[model samples]
Target: MEIDPSEVQSLYRTLAGAVVPRPIAWVSTRSEDGVDNLAPYSFFNVVSVAPPVVMFAPVDGQDGLKDTPANIRETDEFVVNVVTEPLAEAMNQTSATLPHGESEFDHAGLDRAESTTVDAPRVAKTPVAFECSLYEMIDIGASTMVLGEVEWVHVDDSVTTDDKLDVEKIDAVGRLSGSLYATTDDRFSLERPP
Candidate 1:
């Protein structure tokens, strides 16, 4: 239980390395050659609200630039599709190391819909989608963290309730270490004092 990361063969598979409740980011991008790339990143979160920004880190692959980073550099646009329980299997399928020009959307048989403000397409089945333009991309050692400024948001009417996103209806999925998965059904709240 007290194993050091340097001593482990890989950090990702270790239970202690990846903290639970990691939010999923189903990123959609288009390569320079016009191939649509879709992949999931758990190292993702919203950084700001007033300006509306999100960040996700893509680890280096055997190749220098992964599809998501490359695509963002080329088009300067991307979509973050919120993953739900219904789309978990399909989302997992897109994580395969397919060829550079291969379309994960097609590979996973997921429907694609155009975004409102960005050139990139969104996953049609996702309960919520954020259309974003690249804000900044920073190289962090072995990985690159991309910051996206949200330009538009698409929410499924079914999941909207009382002017808020109904978490219970969204049934969003989260990532765990290894092949494990999680849901947002387990809930707790703490209210701040006025």
Candidate 2:
């Protein structure tokens, strides 16, 4: 059945549900006043490889820009932490909206690790974290698509094999419809048609 987004009563839910599984970018940023913020965005993906750019769309909230996007706008720096099965619950906790000056890292009871190149702190327990600088911010309707250039990457030795990240060693978590989440265990590979 074809459904028009404008006609659907629950277009957000419909599109979110139809998207199957989406990777979560647990983005962390620092406010201009140095207040750290963390939030998870499922509307995220890698945009380029050469310069190593990633994009995450954060929809504007009722009062205006969310803390993450606002902080990025001010500082022009952020960190994208990878969400895994072990940290799924904590990641969800960080999604809560708190006072403007409050920090999700403290709210979620997570430790902060100093980033190599950015002022924003990274999740200490995260298996992988990409320290990025703002590449651009584009307004797409109600959402702001934040593009960041990866300046430094932190990968836990346990999750890597011979200096490369091994997916088999990583138990990444993904977003499903509503409050549901998925694991990468059921993955399958296909060869390129040459």
Candidate 3:
């Protein structure tokens, strides 16, 4: 079936559905008023490696800028927490729309760990968390792409092999369309062409 961007009734759904198995960035940020905000964004991935940069796109809500992007704008700091199978339920709980001054960490019943490089708190239960400072924010259509430079990384030893992250151990969850989600359990590797 052929589809046109202008003709598609629900472009967001169509695009999100086609993307298949997008990684979730369980972003946590602290508001200027000291409120801790946490939310999950499926439109997320690594932007660079050498300097260690990551990005996540948060689209404007009906009420305008979401708490995550707005907080990052004010503080220029955030933490990207990895969502594993065990933390999936709690991560989903954080997606609820809360009042501006409310804390999602409390809503999700999750603990916060103080970050070393940034004031933003990290998810204490997450096996991996990246403490980042805002690198840039670009307005892309209806979404704001937040680029962050990794200032510090917290990875539990259980998810590591030879001091490097082990995917099997991490057991990270991925976002599919709608309420569907996936796990990294079913994976395969192929040698790249030289």
Whole-model lDDT per candidate: 0.90, 0.95, 0.94
How do the residues 1-194 of candidate 1 rate in per-residue lDDT, one tens digit apiece? Answer: 68787888767665424588789999998776778889999999999998999999988877688888889988999999999999999999999988768899999999999989987889998989999999999999888999999999999989988878887788999988778889988889999999
lDDT (0-100) at residue 145 of candidate 1? 96
By the TM-score metric, which is better: model 1 or model 3? 3
Model 2 alpha-carbon miss at residue 167, Å: 0.6
What clash pairs does model 1 have? none
Off by over 4 Å in 1: 1-10, 14-18
Stretches of candidate 2 off by over 4 Å are none
Query: In model 3, what are the clashing residue pairs, if there are any?
Result: none
Give the per-residue lDDT of model 3 (tens digit) for 6-76: 87665888789989899999999998999999999999999999889999999988877899999999999
Candidate 3, lDDT over the whole model: 0.94
How well does candidate 3 score on lDDT at residue 60? Answer: 89
Top model number, lDDT: 2
State candidate 3's TM-score. Answer: 0.97
Question: Least accurate stretch of 10 residues (summed lDDT) in model 3?
Answer: 1-10
User: Hey, what RMSD does candidate 3 come out at?
Assistant: 1.0
lDDT of 3 at 55: 98
